[model samples]
Target: MLPFTYALRNLFRDPARLLQTVGGAALVVLLLIAAVALNEGMNSVLENSGSTKNVILMGKGSEESIERSEVPLSAESAVATSVRGLQEVLGVSAVSGEIFYQAPLHIAQGKESQALLRGVLENALLVHRSVQLIDGRFPQSGEVMVGHLAHRKLGVAEEDLAVGESLYFGDTELKIAGRFIAPGTVLESEVWFDRNDLAVLTQRDSLSSVTVRMDAAEFEDVEVFTLQRNDLELAAISEQGYYDKLSTFYEPIKVMTWVTAALVAAGALFGGLNTLYAAFAARIREMATLQSIGFTRKALFVSLIQESLLATLTGTLVAFILGYFILDGLAVPFSIGTFTLTLTPSVIGVGLITGVLLGTIGTLPPAIRCLAPSLPSALRSS
Candidate 1:
């Protein structure tokens, strides 16, 4: 076994070369961490949106998107009456009919943005517990309730959100009466309005979806009855399942992560190999001295590999510290979702393993080259 100080000293012998190798490995680890964090962040967004006790009913032909589904208003009433095991809080049973629309909104700040519009009845807040009032008042007939992210992006403050302040969307101008927050869900990026007002404005009389709450223990019976109705053609699914299906919308992202990782690794591997070869090139006399002292070829090779591994481990530690603080809390927006990068335990593990493997694999060929010659031959060349 080599002393820890020996490996440490060997790496720092050529400060420039050591830094290059470490920096290359560090950059690869950083890219890997960032990629995995995105997937985890997206998963968190969807998982938080899902509730085990809630069920979503959409038109039969629609696979995942509520925006594409159009359920007749009469179906909501029929499902409510026939569905057994429906949970009720207070006197009202836990069922709500809702509509979804997307439109280009002209910000009062002189910027044009497209936002998803969700039209809800009075019990929306009660059914979705995450919805909380942060300011002003609830929506009146012609008013809108803005989400936190919407407020931030649209530059609409609570003071600016008065009962009669008009916002132009296409040919319509809706008033802003309140602001709400629903944490850890895509709802935070939407604007809520009265269903009747939205339907009139959008020229759609039908609802988009219906949500019902039932006892988790009785989910089996409720699911069977809800889907087996002879007159209604609809699909009923757990809210969790519905959100999980939404992952398909971002499927390209997972593939993109792997592709980026592979590219970074290829670059890192080449850079690491070059640095290790340069380090060995400079230490030709040192290898000759080791051979003269009866240190076997295998020992010399192992020492070089260990030296490379030490340098990479240092970089990985630095990257972990930097990535957790600098990369986390970064919010990136897209048409379908907004994600904040996060480094979970699994992500960190992957980064570390990648760095170490790059170090070991990059050093092997150079280490073998350094050990192949006779002591007199290597010494005579320098």
Candidate 2:
């Protein structure tokens, strides 16, 4: 068997080729990381947005979109009185009638971007355990609380979303009263305001949804209530289940991201293959000489693989470092909300596995072809 050191040393024989191979592999790995990160971040946001202990009561036909749903204002009271095992906070049932609106928000004198706005009552905090006021105070009339990633979604600077700053929602100018965070959830990209204030601005007389906190065991009661109340046209769904549906709805987009990455990586693979072929061809005579010295073909093949793996692994390391510094925790905005790309354990595992596969698969054909000829022919030719 060839010593591992022999394989390692051979990589540096032509520094230019080594760099090119490593650089190509690094680019491919980086692209794969980005693709995986995008999908992971988006999925994480949607999956974390919901809580199993909470239930959302939306209009029956608009189960897919809370923004389009319209539940009667009286449904909140109905759900509280009718449902059993609902959580309570300070003698008040943990129920919040919310209004959701999507509108263009003016963040500066001339800048505007589309944003998701949620209108919440005080009890909203009790039910939304993921949310926490990190700065200033909760919103009041003519005031709005921005999410941590709201500025990113709004295409504005962080300073523009600070407390005391003002933004325009339609013709209404609202002050930024606070900043809140709902970590790992899509709520981190929304603007929250008083329900009545939003109702007035959007001229929405009806609530979008009523969210209630209850035990999982009591979900059937809420569901039964929804089914019994034919006049209300209400539907009950677990908050977690609602977000799961959203994730499923966006699955195609995530798949397309992977497809795009695969296409680009295929191009890189082919480019790397061509470079390896040339490099191996140049070393045919050297390999034949080693064969004459009693080195088995399998041993030579293993050494070539080790060399390829080393270069690709180096590239993978560079990709990981770049992803951590440049991509991780970076906020990306989409139609619904913004999500921060994270270099999670699973994503890192995928990147590492992809690198190993590239190294093994890209080197095999080239190495085999270089060793195909008889020893005497290889020695005579090159």
- The reply for model 2, stretches above 4 Å from the true place, is 215-217
TM-score of 2: 0.97
The residue-by-residue lDDT of candidate 2 on 1-382, one tens digit each, is 9999999999999999899989888989999999989998898888888998989999988999999999999998998888878888778989999999999998756689999999998899989988999999999999999999998998888988999999998777899999999998888899998999999988999999999999544888889999889889999899999999999999899999989999998998899999999999998999999999999999999999999999999999999999999999899999889998999898899899989988998899999999999999999984
- lDDT: which candidate is best? 2
**C-alpha lDDT of all candidate models, in order:** 0.77, 0.91
Pairs clashing within candidate 1: none
Best candidate (score: TM-score): 2
Model 1 lDDT tens row, 1-382: 4455777787777788878887888888888888888788888888898888888888887847899998888877776777766776786777789999888777565666677888998767656878898877778777898876774444445344444566776767778887777887877778888889888888898899888877543567656765677455677788888888877767787788779887976788787787677778777778888777777777777777788888888889878988978888776555654656777789899989977887687777888787677788888867
